[model samples]
Target: MATATRRSATRTGRTTGRRRRWTAALGAVALLAGTAALAGPAHAMAAASAPVDFATHCVPPPIAGIPPIDGTTTAQITVDNAAPKVGDTVTVTYTVTKPAASNPVDLALPADIMTPTGKVALGGAQTGSVTVTGPKKNPPVPGKGSFPPFSMTGTFKVTAPGSITLAPGDYNIHTSYIMELDTPCTVITPPAPVSETVVATDVPGANERSIQLTTASGKPGDPVTVTGAKFAPLADITVAGRAGAAQTADRTTVKADAAGGFSAQLTVNDKATTGIVAYEGAAWSAEKGAGPAAYTVIDDTPAPPNSQKLNSSVKAGTLSMSQAGDTVALSAVDFGAGGASTGDLNTVTVKDFRGGPAGWSLTGKVTDFTGPGGKIDAGRLGWTPACTTKAGSPSTCVAGSAGVVGSAGATLASTPNGAVTGGEFTVGAKVTLNVPAYTAPGAYSGVLTLTLT
Candidate 1:
């Protein structure tokens, strides 16, 4: 009986192993079916191709007898993808057929020199225009017999869900030789007969992110408040300001809140140009994550004062000057066979707040140096002046030439009358004193005065 029980247990174990294998196979199949269900259905639309003809009126180059050329051209347009979801990009190709007409005059059509650019009108679900451009692949035409056929491509993003129709519109052909010659061609009459259609499907929660700005205009060093919404929660986002041709160097990164929203601030660059700057926010993992807020950079230069007669009396502004220190001490030198001693003079600052166009000047005068060795003439003291004007100020400061600062005084710096916007200016100099040989040993001191007007 015991042996029989052992055999029975082995048989049961084999049966259970087979049952587990069968269950695992069924589970694998069910997982695949669930994945397919989540994917829904295939939404890709078949590619479409069509032919279009245009009755073009082209303005040809000026030759004594050559007038405008009215001709018919053929093109084949192919939509790479006719069905795209919202936020998807689609590419369309425009292939032109070589014209049979001969050149009116001898023309050298260099490779890639002839460029064609035009817009394709959109209808149906979208109401806007898409720009198309072709690479410079035109074969060199020694004396144009018939223009070669070429292809151009354009791409646009699907913004809305619906059927979008494309119709060929106006375009221009540009050729450069001795002078730039652009032939503007217009589609004549009944419009282009051929048109292509694209269907855009809606993707839930796609391209819903948005960015807003607190202010639309600012000057350099100004702060701009940026806010973002409808982004992924806790997502890392980068926000930046961009101009048409210039890019701002400022950017900030922040984390979205639990509600899929974020807020940050960015400062404008000091050298930013005046134009419409778009502040954009983007996230790497999010599709169509970029959103733009337009900001204009206004010219910070204050407008000129309006000329008006005031009924009340107005106080006049003032121009003033001050020195960093009261006195300048030269390096002590031995009197035995002396040559010269030099030291840096104290810095002098001049400020002009007067709102008028009248300019000002700064002068420096010195008294005779006196000590135990009698006195030294002030004319013996010379200085090389250095002048600097404040940054971003319209004022232009000119330093005075190197010369002796005697009792009569000498120019240290000056501003021209063209400086309508007064600003602060700083002046510095290196003072030198010439001592004769066999001079008596003693300490000398001199008083220097600076005057501004």
Candidate 2:
């Protein structure tokens, strides 16, 4: 008879494989449970079953005279609800007809001492692993013999409308006595064919709500326009912005119009840090619905030369503009006799989501450069504009001609009146400041205002 200590020693040889098996099984179980909780409401229920036979490789106890075991396991899978709705949890039963490998020792296996855990790989409409655990139900084995086959049950929720394919993966068996014996088995190469496919359909009258931000990035205390659509008509809604543990300074509750839409302004918290703020709107109903939009918070403090500022503005029914910062700083340069100092302006992004043929333009103007030595004419500043449209845009972005941009302002970029469409365009410019021969020697600053229409 093999002593308990000897059996424990033999188990040590497969420790690595056992650890991997349990980790995968537990992770799959957690993923399945989380996904199920997020599903909406289930549709009508149905039932179906399929037979699966697959080859497996099992690592037997490290007995001096035994080798690794290879065998076949056959099982039948039955789905209780084959056509579930988005939020419905479906039950599945797996019945085994044969064990992958038999016990190689003459140890008496007691009743209710054997437990089995199995895994099924999912694909298609959803992707993840589903774990099935069986209760301890083995009959007393008098001596060296085959493990009894048993049935296991598991459940998973359908998260979206599509076809999900289920296939057998791997499994493990544990028998407890003086010490526990774990046998890890892996599916052979060229995995078994898909066991079954279940279709998950959407709930009736489920309309998806959406939210969009006028500008996607801004500084603290900046006001952002939040627009929502496709909500329940006359629904009371609460819109909030959150960035990690911090919440926006402004939160609004409003009533949706007859068309199931609403608009409100949210102010970024004055103490908010730089990060992405997610704006979410929840509609009040028996079954609440929510939509999300994202805004990036940026630092607004002025830095040394070459530092950039971001700014953006959007018209309610037309074009939208976003910049990298609130201020743009050109690199400091020593003024040479009758020479010029130059730097590149930060890029500005303009997006047309209005789906119209009416075109738009961007222009910039600068205040006169003022310092201890007096003032330099704003007309001394000139720029060479450049424009690039995103691939697939219907509009042709025309760069503005290089010229002086005085207080009156100048066109940085524009689109033909008939070429406007839904797309994004970025505009930038190389700025040159003409220095007078006898200019004063103090630092000077000016404000550059950008406008989009």
Candidate 3:
């Protein structure tokens, strides 16, 4: 008795859909009811044995199509083989079915092939010349006939440390009995196929990149900001030659006051002082793919000192003289009212230094004199003196000394001087001059500029 069933064929289906219909009645009868003679001393005998049908199937996993990732797929394949490395080895299961006439059996395998540059290099050949075999008993299903599995196996090894030029591929190869599993036969035979590919990371290609930052004038201690305009987000930054935190970035926004941009504050470190400075971006091929950018550093230092460099100033002015032959005559010297005249000699006396010179004193002999004398105060007077042909002249001042060679010097009788005027601060005392009968004549002058400072 043959049971009838329909075979469904759907191509391009990655998953399988199975349909089973059970028989409610086998046309069997109760031997007890129909029998007296049928059961005379009932002994049992074995019914016709239905051979087990091993199904044949072949399928492949989907290949990665995403361009950004460029990935591939892997699949697991099993077979009913007489010499299987794994799986049930006890019973040699077999399958029998008619091979489809249309769509000549297609042996699908992985497209991933390993080359010297390929992803895998196991040491075996680049292209596999593998053969798949099935069991010897290739019979039809139950209603058709009984048969054992068609088992055959091909063994190959993948050996490579780094991939010899190219690596050998890995696969779960199986013997295929390409037949319609949709058949109504008691055993469905599927197309057995082996598949595998080199699944490994190729030695990553070497990579690199850089970024640059600059100031209008690359001067030390100048405030300059380096923005990673060319770099994408998540780029590392270094500050003042000091390595910074990972990928310190800035935010982007369209708001009016939005602070959109990544910035690296560089204080211009001494180490980074190259007369030129730059902030750079480099190989950040992490997430996806991209190139690198570099920057140069500039140094600027020779600028003149600021106008506010020194904020204070000082000026000096005074009036003084030394003793001549025998008389002393005082003329305008450092006229600035900056200091005082004091000692066992005399206290500082402010006097008029305008319209004439200061007065001097007499020493050894009377000397010729000129210029009108005016009372600087009650004590000091303004006057000028000159040397005369004769000593002991009534109009001349005389000098007094120790009678020694140079000791017979002029003693200033009156040397014109004055107190501080126009915000002048006094310092030391004044020198005295003496008119001498033989004193030399010469115009001595000195500037006395006083300052509020």
Candidate 4:
């Protein structure tokens, strides 16, 4: 007897011809099952007439000498979205190569269309059209080969229904050959069952927003532009200033174009303050909003003219000292007596009027000193002075010894323009006399001139 066995082994082979062998095999099985009743004993008829035992198998176990079909078929599954969110229509696509004809390709997904972890549940899967992608001239019908080495794609859509979130997991596509299990066809070998897994990454809901303005600052009545890239399509944008009041513009409302890009210029109001103004915006149809861009409005009024005024209240009556170190402190009144007074001292009040210059140079020059009898040395009389910008403020002293002013006259003090305030300043002085003990005692006087610039 010659024993024939079917088996599977990787082998390179080509298709020989097309035939209808599967139908004949079915008919032969039907004949055998029917004749069993007549040939068997009456008591065993029902059992004997049972259908012939032909276990369904695909690419059967390898025979002793025969080789398995060659030229492997490869398929890859892709999705429009790597991570699908809830309520998103996820597209699952299959690109297949070297597909066989006369066999139907079956794609099997999880029965419930839910994630393996049971976190996400889709509405259901819907199969879309299958498209042939090869042969520029005329594409072959997918799985009905008229061309060799061709590629085709099948697509399906899954809707992530309402709020059931799909957690992170692998969603697999199971594929197999339906008809090629029993009936073999040339140019078609049932590819071994394979699975392709797609990873889930996001839970569907609200998306984050990013929006901004080109420039933050502008003067009153000037144009400031605003832009947003993530707003809803064709949505209207409303802009406002610090008070949340809608900004006045040539166009108060601007709409975002189809791609969610928006741009519009708004003018700062004339009544705006000289300080900073913050701007913000919102899309009419959006759940979120954007920005507080700071803008500054400046005042542009000119200032007034300045003037400088000087007054002095010195108790300049007489000078008398008992010893070389003896000092006579003169009482001096400032802009007013109660206002400011270096008691028993001399003080000059300096004021800068609206039209006056900012600063001045003061120099004290003394001529030859004279007494009731004859002349005395001018260097014998010296003074120390200090200045104060405000009436009640403390005074800052000039760098000098207590008795240093001489016949030639020295720079007592020099002040910068800003050291004075409220258009006024005050200068206080303390005078000291250095007299030889043996010198004749008599009334003495000297002319002191003050030059102000």
- Across residues 110-225, which tens digit of lDDT does each residue of candidate 2 receive? 67666666666667887655555565567876666888887655545455677877777677766655455667677887456677777778875543454545544455678777
Q: Weakest 10 consecutive residues, lDDT, candidate 3?
A: 26-35
Candidate 4 stretches with Cα past 4 Å from truth are 1-345, 354-357, 391-402, 418-422
Off by over 4 Å in 3: 1-210, 214-217, 229-236, 239-261, 275-453
Clashes found in each candidate (C-alpha, N, C closer than 3 A): 0, 8, 84, 20
RMSD per model, one decimal:
34.1, 29.5, 54.7, 46.5
Per-residue lDDT tens digits for candidate 4, residues 204-283, read 45432323333333335777565555556776666544322233232345777898667776665643421112112442
> lDDT for model 2, on a 0 to 1 scale?
0.57
Q: Which predicted model would earn the best lDDT?
A: 2
Per TM-score, the best of the predicted structures is 1
396-421, model 1: which lDDT tens digit per residue?
A: 89999999887777888888643133
lDDT-better candidate, 2 vs 4 = 2
lDDT of each candidate versus the true structure: 0.55, 0.57, 0.21, 0.30
TM-scores of the models, in the order given: 0.38, 0.36, 0.13, 0.23
Task: Tell me the deviation in Å of residue 404 in model 3.
Answer: 99
Sorted on lDDT, best first, the list reads 2, 1, 4, 3
